[model samples]
Target: MPNYWGPFAQLKEQTNAILEVANYNGLMAELNDALFIDRSDIAYYVDLAKEAGGPILELGCGSGRVTLPLLSGGYHVTGVDNSQDMLDILSKRMQHRSREEQSRLTMCREDARNFQLGNAFSLVIFPYCSLLLFTDPADRKSILKSVRRHLTSSGLFAFDAPVQESLNQERIFELDLPIESGKTVVTLGIKTYHEQKVMLENSLFQVAKSTNKRYTILEYKKLALFAEGELEQELQEAGFYVYKRIPTLSDNGKTLRYLYVCGKSDTDTYPLWHPYMPHNQLPNHVLTLVSGQGCRVTDQHGKTYIDASGGLWSVQCGLGNTYIIDAITKQLSTLSYGTLFAGRGNEPALALARKLVELAPYPLEWVYLTGSGSESVELSIKLARQFWHFAGLANKNRIVYLDQSYHGTFFGSMGVSGLYPAKETVGPGLPGLDCINAPNPDNCPPNQDYETYALTCAEQLETVARLKSDQIAAFIIEPVLGSAGVVIPPQAYFDRIAEICQRHNILLIVDEIATGFGRTGAWFCSTHFGIKPDIMLLSKGITSGYLPLGATLFSAEIGNRLLAHGAGIMHGSSHNGNPACCVAALATIDVLTNQQLIKRAREAGHYVRELLEQMKNEQPNVSGIRSLGLMAGVALCQNDHKPATKEQVAVIYELLKRKGVLAYPAVSSVVFFPALTITDDELQTVVQKLGEVLSSVQLVNNGTRMR
Candidate 1:
């Protein structure tokens, strides 16, 4: 944690110069005799080491200050420092100890900011104010992450930092320790304050006590400072929770320092913000996925489950596909990475774009590559407004989305989303955005047929378009709502919607991020509906989750006009059209086409639907079932036919997990999106397990009580 030679090479040089003085041959002994003579902190650190149960790692351990004491206390210690001179000094002291005592100590010269011990420790200690030396935020983070990696799951990371009051002023002092009858080691300490930190400089010299004459300079040293609370926040952000803080005062009773004891929040300290997941209630036993093959994934516990979620509805070609992996490997060897910006293009990007257009629905002649589904949706919104701006309809900038729809999680994309909670949680929605109810067959009137309900829903779009035609830029919809329990619209719905949008000059936007790449028995859901959208969003299965990639496809009518505009598409991502991602996408498409997975998806859809229908027939709790190709959901309900509670949905999924099936729970339903290549036996096993789980959870009287 000390600055070392990184930005304080002058300090290192000063130490080297003082070491070269022939008069100061025994400098190590002088340092311990003068500076650390009355270090009351050693006992406290020893007790912590006992509680932590070493072998311990002491970073930035100068000489044998803390390391030797810990070794003497019958504990194994590994001393790491960036200076070889300090390690050599510690090694020299170790030679004087017995063989067993020497064996308890190990010294390694390594940077405190970055080091690989290739070993785990029970306690990792950064004594002194070493952590404060790392003023750079990146360096501090690196050190904390390193400590976390080297610690055992139950281990502790303890470090002492100076208090803000300690560094408020500068002070100087001198200490004399008798080395012999007439000779003494004199230590001069000087402290200074800077903008946010304090610097301590110490110089050691040998002098005659009687004459008070300086003999030779033994060593010159500098230490770093840190502010209080700064380190605690950094520790939490780095996935560590400080359970204890032991404050200690200086020998003069003026300065104060605190020793923080931290433990890993959990083995999975990713600090990742999972979408739609509540942070406070995160399960301690969360599944740690390690590896996967085909339609099954194995957790860290070595248990395998049928990946019914298909990696969030993206792994259509299955997990660990070699074709995609090899394509990515090959692309990495050749280009590695290249951006499609300022007209600079890579081979894989160009080839992937051409391939997308070839397989895309009719008139989707151009592809704008992005980094992910959210980015794709975000770019599409920008492009839509850009087109209207070019066509002299600058006022046509309003975006309309359907209710219960999830487009993406970006600002503009989330703004156009219809989920109430999503909008409320994100604060404000983008201006000029509106929402209308989607065509859900389940929500139809009692007497209306499927077509009549579809027409009724489609009329909402016409009403909005007519009322806000001057402001409505585009109307976006997911052919099948994947996130909202995989709601499948009636066939008549898209036919009516396309007619209405075209008549009102409202651009139709299709978001097939989840349903794309043959998930719904076709390349894209727009094709199945026989509707040509002016713009389309795609991701997830584009590369089958091999890498991050997304695309926004545009029809000729829009692509050409946007191209002719002088302003151009005013946007791009740093990794947009990344070569490796493009290659993975290309390989995924090839796998889908060559292996005829699209045809298999259709066959799988038929098999899944039949099985789900039987499960529904057998269990009254299985009140509703809806599916399209590989994506399917079974809604659980009470005996009176009301939607199940959130608790009930959780219980159902836990049962499914216990039965070796991994399915996602969306509201009151359990959704399954198995890999396209999943065998019929696997599919039957998953559905059978689900049925068993559904039959076990029966509500008595619709009061939310399960038997």
Candidate 2:
């Protein structure tokens, strides 16, 4: 201590100077002492900028405090300030950089309240409590208005301000930070309250031993302190959504500062590392989901959105159910895994299979389990072929599916799907798969009512079956088409297809990946039409998204025949009937039965249909609005009732997402399959937002209006 204090004892010339704060007053003051300006927490700004994914607009970019770091991090930054001297100093610092690095930083002496760059920016940041400089409410509104215009479609605007939690309490702080060799800055600050704002007055002493130089300066600053939750409300009224509010700790370990991250109300889309997607089309950083409760999921940045599609139309019991979680936890802790291989078995698998037989709406059955819907569908294809081959009809092995229908993406399942786009990429799938027309009442041929259209499409199945009558092993169809964009045909359509399969001696397979588990107002939508398929493919809401489980259910007769043939169903999965997953399915089924969610789905369906009627009346772009049991689709079209182009449907999807109502985008329609447990009020809100957005995009094309 003695050596440290006495090292700079040599006499030197004394100097006095005043170092003003960044925004002293309304872009009026000049910072003459740039070297002594506060430079704390500059790294925090840089990290936040990286999260935002710029081009960035930095307000009050004094002394290149946060700008240089942002530029170095590969972000294009435009620094705006009202101080010419500050801009000049920052400009001088940039002189040594190469052309490319220099191009990343833009300097301008413009007021934050009003400036027009004539372009959009992804992130607009006001660092270092600069937002507090705008004391006037009008000034704040004007600044936000400008920011809103300059923001991109999904852009964010962030700023920080002092919380001043200890305003009335007396506070004293002394800080000595070493800058360079033999030089130190010592600040003694006294905080006082004036006009309900914190005023900081400090005496700074700078001394250097190598040059024997000494300097003393007086600094004074005042800020309009805001209360917690006060800024969030103001931001909302200014057309910005409060994304996150973070409290930053002070040097004394007290949280006296806060950072408010905000986004425009029209913001949409974030970085997501998606599978089976082109990398160039994805965002820079995927959304970090933190917690999910009910149908809503909260991301890491504190943004919450409803999973209306029931997490791929399978979250039958909603999410975050304590009973389901407890069941999985208990099973995992006791017996995490067990499989149906080498004659091995577990209690959960047998218990669930027994439960399925009891709950089934058809004749007594046998159940085969797998890990996912694709696996189940793939197994169904194999089982159908196996059943025929064992029955002495080896040539009857072709699979048939309704046109525009989607089963799964595995080779056999994909071969049976009629979705051309998905099949185009992985073409030449399993060979003998035939197609039949799926009923689409909305797009009925001219002068044909829905019944006529239904019959016309259903007859295609008979046509294909007659041509390849003995060659077709089974006819697979979704009671209500799911991945082809929520297409729901009339009951007669499925009934006719079932009748055809029965007559042709081909097994009828129901693919219920999206429509099973009480999603369509019934335990199984095939029951809604009063018909039973010879075989059924089930997954998705089976585990309510808690775990993966797929099952293929066969009638007693087919099960007996398949088992009687020599080697008793020569198929086994590594994870067939996984105990933990089976337990999850059991819990999910218990929840479905105990909560009476299926009945509520029907009730909510009526509520949703009424709302859709209103939407059809108000939104000119809404041509065909279909709603059944909380599952709906609003197909866009020309006034002539022609299907809208795929591009237009994508645009509608973007608009809905920007408004925070996420819907599945289909070929030419937006799929609306909210959870069966969704409240009436939530349904109403979704309809209102979707209707409002649809009404806004009144486009005209091909000599026809959107309606």
Best by TM-score: 2
Instruction: Compose the digit string of candidate 2's lDDT tens values, residues 1-707.
Output: 11111112111123324433443321212222233245434545564564455699988887676777777777899999888877877787788766787988888889889998967898898876777667676788899899889987568787876665556434544555554434545544545455564444344445444567444444444445556466666786777876555655465677666677677763354455475555433342234469887877777667777777777777878879999999999999999989898889999999999987876768748899888888888988888888888889999998888778887778877777787455667656798888877787656777988877997888887888888769989888887776556777887777777788778988888887778888888887777887687788889988998898998888887787776875477666789999999999999998988999989989998888888887888766677777668678777775545677776676567566656676777756888777777888888878888887676555445321121
> Model 2 — TM-score against the truth?
0.64
Error of 1 at 493 (Å): 1.4
After superposition, candidate 2 runs with Cα above 4 Å error: 1-153, 156-273, 284-288, 420-422, 702-707
- Residue-level lDDT of model 1, residues 239-337, one tens digit each, is 787756666557476656777778776645456656666663233326779999999999877889999999878998999889889889988999998
RMSD of each: 17.2, 19.4
In terms of lDDT, model 2 sits at 0.73
- List TM-scores for all candidates, in order: 0.62, 0.64
When summed lDDT is taken over every stretch of 10 residues in candidate 1, the lowest stretch is 1-10
TM-score attained by model 1: 0.62
Clash count, candidate 1: 0
